[model samples]
Target: MACENMKRVQKEAINNWRDHLKRKLTGQSVGTKDWLSSIKQQQDFSRDDSIPPLTAPDGSVVTSHRGKAQVLAAHFSSKMTVPDPEREPPTVPVLTKASLGNITITTEEVLQQLQQAPAAGIASWGKRWQVTLAPDKIQAILISRRQDAVNWDQHAILLEGRKIHLQESVNILGVEFDSGLTYTSHVRKVAKDAAWKLSCIRLVAHLLDAQGFGTLYKSQVRYLMEYSPSHGPPAPVIPPPP
Candidate 1:
């Protein structure tokens, strides 16, 4: 008799679940709102009197609920340590300008990358995962930490008897890099560019509310710097002039 009762209960449960799903699909039910509310209210779940077996701190397994709770409480309490007023401050490394190695390797495998010609205009992409490199558009930049500046306009690198002129800086994917690798030139250019964009946005600032203006700024002016490969100091938000 008990086995038959169990089977009946399971069948009723399955039917009710099917009905609930059908109602939800047909838009007759309250949808996920009802489910979400149940979660927030902590309802519909059956009570669980059992807890997982826990190991005690003293190397023995704790089985009792009260003992488990006490062990957990002790474990949690140990995590919070009072800070000593006289404790010496921890040491941290000083921040300095990053250095890059100057490698002059032109292996046979990557010889095409080293090839450059007297270039004109550039810079593309697709999921087809293809790239076309024009030798004339390839620009070369030499990164160095030397204090003295080189007259790059007069220097050129040779590849397969073709003269490849050296540039003081190279612009790759919207980020500019100079020979020094200090990003000083990149910062200067970003500031100048951002200033012009800020001025353009300022003209229509009066027309937009705070939220609207912010959205516009993020989409256009702010993201211009945000999406860059490396970021410089943030450009100040110039207030709209009265």
Candidate 2:
């Protein structure tokens, strides 16, 4: 009789445990630990990208016909420092008309010309090393024309929200004399109120030249002149190009 009673008690206890588990799984507020442990476990899996490269038995270092596979592996391993989602990129500074230091050109006049007649602005002011203005919403320059004699094509880098788009065809004097002049495909756009002034475009251009991209790509211009909000349009170029 005692054994039978013990069996019944065991069955009841098992049933109660199942019910408790069901409640917890359904989020019915049964006592449990914080959800952070699960989240942390997921994050750990996402961050880990460690891998080892193959080494030859001779230990003198191996090089393949396609270059060193181990070298490429090591490079990728070094880049594992930044995870896919853990790191956030550094913020970019705003640009303003006042930031255009030492540039005496009338920005208001340029802005007006861009709004009224886009083609005229490029023809009159979009020369080599000229600080041209454009709508903030425009990011990349759309090359409507290209010169046949020039070795380069039209493609200007955009500063995103900072610069006005001079999508109209314009020439960029190469960093080196041998590089020759190339037409800008499109200009990169930037924020009107960037943290780094647009006036620094020349310096940036030099850096890009050092990286060899300048020869292949157009460097963005920095408008360092101060921009008076009251003097010109106030709207932040919203509704960026689709």
The parts of candidate 2 lying over 4 Å away from their true place are: 1-61, 65-67, 82-167, 173-242
For candidate 2, the TM-score is: 0.17
Q: How badly does each model clash, as a count of residue pairs?
A: 0, 51
RMSD to native for every prediction?
Answer: 16.9, 25.5
Candidate 1 residue 8 C-alpha distance from true site, Å: 33
Q: Whose lDDT is greatest here?
A: 1
Provide the lDDT at 13 for model 2: 82
TM-score of 1: 0.38
User: Where does model 1 exceed 4 Å of error?
Assistant: 1-136, 145-156, 230-242
lDDT of 2 by residue, 39-111 (tens): 3333442223232223554555443423356556666787876556767888888666566457564535544
Q: Over the full model, what C-alpha lDDT does candidate 1 score relative to the true structure?
A: 0.60
Give the alpha carbon lDDT tens digit for every residue of 106-137 in model 1: 34423334343223222223213455655776
Whole-model lDDT per candidate: 0.60, 0.39
